[model samples]
Target: MDKAIIVFSRKGLFQKTLSAFDIRSREHARKLWPLVSFDESRQMVTWVSPSFENGRLRRRAHFRVLPTQTSYNPKQHFDNQENHRWNTVKESTEHRLAKELITAEISRRLNYGLGMPWRFKDKDVSNFPFLGNLLLGADRVVRLCCTKI
Candidate 1:
């Protein structure tokens, strides 16, 4: 069957949201990890990976903040095989028409529930407006260069 990695998330500053929850502990997937359509019409990422053209790789990549709890996908965000699928799904998500996206795109998840204008603190980055934790309509996405990268 063809695959279409349709990430289940709301629209935001990001051109696209993650398609499926990251595979965490093989029991639960981290929320918002891009979904795998598994349909040939779309895309699929196997435990292993397939190669692509170099130019294709460079063109599809766009920078955005990531979550710190990478334990969800302990496989490493840049895992050779998985990273390709991750990026493909992400690019497709962002380019699709906004009418198709969901409310959660610009909102946040909270202990009480999920909603908008969230105040999330990334201990990873000691600053306000952290990535994923955005002050939408506020103009800038908050990002802290705390990662040694």
Candidate 2:
């Protein structure tokens, strides 16, 4: 099975309409990422996964974006599509750590509560360090930061 790792989320002013996934080999120094964008004429979303050679990464015309059959609805957005995509992807023990890392980070941002019914597999997934109260406090800080900007 091919392994992929999400190095980090690349969000900024320049790439406003795209989300990138940086994948790298944990055993080697190789790096790769998928840059997702919308193709208006094709009416389909594009996923461009790049391969690197000569240990250098660059924007070149040799790469191609493959079109998947999946069509995203603008009204509903990615909430439903993400759930379906997650279920369709083949799960393996190799990527368990990467999955847990992303899950924990999202759970942290959402402030997962013990009372919530959401579960990972058959068990309820709860956030450690109990940040519910902290999130409330952080909301004030976030507002202050936003207002300053």
Best lDDT among the predictions, by candidate number = 2
TM-score of each: 0.16, 0.21
Give the per-residue lDDT digits (tens) of candidate 1, residues 1-149. Answer: 12223344355322242322232332333343443433332232322122248645423222222334222232453485665765555534344444234323433233234435445677777867544533433432232222222
- Candidate 2: tens digits of C-alpha lDDT, residues 32-71: 2322233432233323345568877664222233356353
The per-prediction CA RMSD against the true structure, in angstroms, equals 22.2, 17.1
What is residue 18's positional error in candidate 1, in angstroms? 5.2
Stretches of candidate 1 off by over 4 Å are 1-4, 12-22, 30-34, 37-40, 43-149
C-alpha lDDT values of all predictions: 0.36, 0.38
Question: What TM-score does structure 1 among the candidates reach?
Answer: 0.16
Query: CA shift at 86, candidate 1, in angstroms?
Result: 36
